[model samples]
Target: FFWGFLAGFLEIVPYVGTTIGGILPVFYMLMVSDTLWQPLAVIGLYILVQQIEGNIISPNIMGPSIKINPMFIILGLFVGGIVWGISGMILALPILAVSKEIFRSFDATEPLSYLMENGLARKKDVFLERFDHEKHRILRLFFEKREEGE
Candidate 1:
């Protein structure tokens, strides 16, 4: 009962929430159970549930609905937690979705929207290309100086 409640409550935080929720109950079982099989069974059950939820449910259902990359979500989670603790983590996804839309709506900020989006169909990295060009130039200059004994 308590484990269910913990799992449900922590589900709001995304990613690691379900994991922590499942782990605590397993820890409690380990401490109290005389037989090791019970705790092992609990661990197995949690793994199965996590796999189903993460691989099957999330990719098919939540993926299209959210549309944001997992990387951005993870980044937002960190930033939110750092800024406002648990409440921030709970609010991060909605805030990020809204911000992505806001960025999408304006021509000036559309690039940010692209950045936040899942990159499954994206063909090129605009920022990375520019960064790579500068990097090559810097490396060329450095090598030239080394060759000239400077």
Candidate 2:
């Protein structure tokens, strides 16, 4: 039940997060039980609950709050899993969502926020960001060299 609740709570994250959440209890049950049916039953319950959350609960609750496209959520989940393993997968969605909200404020990252919605990132956003960072580094170094000369 706790695992089911956790899975539902993390419904906003794409594919892998929920799966991770759901599997924990099933594994626990499998280890403790002598019979296979109990674990299979837990898996079924998790699946049913997942369907409800996906079709009903999340659309009403998380839709207005996060506003991220499903594709990016999956991408973030995968990236987080790769970098941080299970903990990362669990955390990635909220981290990505918060970052996206922050990114929405800057004109430079506005396109990035849009890209989160559809995964269709424009080259302009990437190039401009890289260019700006490089430009700043060059300018800072130039000023530092001039100050040293003086």
Candidate 3:
């Protein structure tokens, strides 16, 4: 019951919190029970819950509200984990969301919000813009060389 409440509260933290919530119950079960199957069953239940949450619940909630790339979230989660273990991973998504909101205020930083966007269009725009910039540089270099030769 305590673990359930913790899980409910920390559900706001994204995958890391859900994961911790799921694992803690298993540990609790193991400590209180003699049967190995009890803990194993809890693990299985957690896995099922995780699968459902990932495929269904999260997309429904996070797709609109969080509005960030899942891959980026995973990357942030990993970076947080490396830097400060479970706690960092748990906090990373909300921190990232807040950061995205802050960056949204300025025109210069507006482009960065698209970096976190889940859609391919924004990413394509950024890539195409960079390609155009580089192409212009290369063309300028070639023209300069030709002019020098002439």
Candidate 4:
């Protein structure tokens, strides 16, 4: 139940959304608990749950649909924190996501095309020469299987 709620809440913001949402529970436990050890325990529990989510859960559940770069998210949080306080930090990445989608629409394509070409779409293309002939062997195996199937 707690995990479910955290997952849903984290879905709203891109990038560090999960981390941002994870902080709330830790702070709440620290603030409400009587003993120092209780807060420490809650923090440990949060880290454990986050590890599980990152390794097993997120890979299977949110594998392809929710893919966002971590750098952008960090920038969002920093800018948002600077601008509008904690709430801004929370909202910045989501707003960027929504705006990015909107800008990608056909109606806004011209301006967005230039922006994307200049900003996000720039990437280094590295060429590598392989010594092993494994790729050809793998292709031949696949072709043989397809031919056999037919």
Whose lDDT is greatest here? 1
Expressed as tens digits, the lDDT of each residue in 1-150 for candidate 2 is 566578667666667678788888888998999999999998988788778867998688977778777888888989999999988998988998899988778755655676676434445576456545543343454465454556
lDDT of each: 0.81, 0.75, 0.77, 0.61
How many clashing pairs per prediction, in order? 0, 0, 0, 0
User: How well is each residue in 87-123 modelled by candidate 4, as lDDT tens digits?
Assistant: 8987875776676566556432323322322223343
TM-score of each: 0.54, 0.48, 0.54, 0.41
| Model 4 backbone overlap count | 0
**Clash pairs of candidate 4?**
none
Model 1 over residues 61-109: C-alpha lDDT tens digits? 8789889989999999999999999889989999999999998786556
> Which order, best to worst by lDDT?
1, 3, 2, 4
Residue range 109-142, candidate 3, lDDT tens digits? 6555667768857569665575444333434544
Question: What is the C-alpha local distance difference test score of candidate 2?
Answer: 0.75
State candidate 2's TM-score.
0.48
Candidate 4: worst 10 consecutive residues by lDDT? 124-133
After aligning candidate 2 to the native by TM-score, how far in Å is the CA of 125 from where it should be? 16
lDDT against true structure, model 1:
0.81
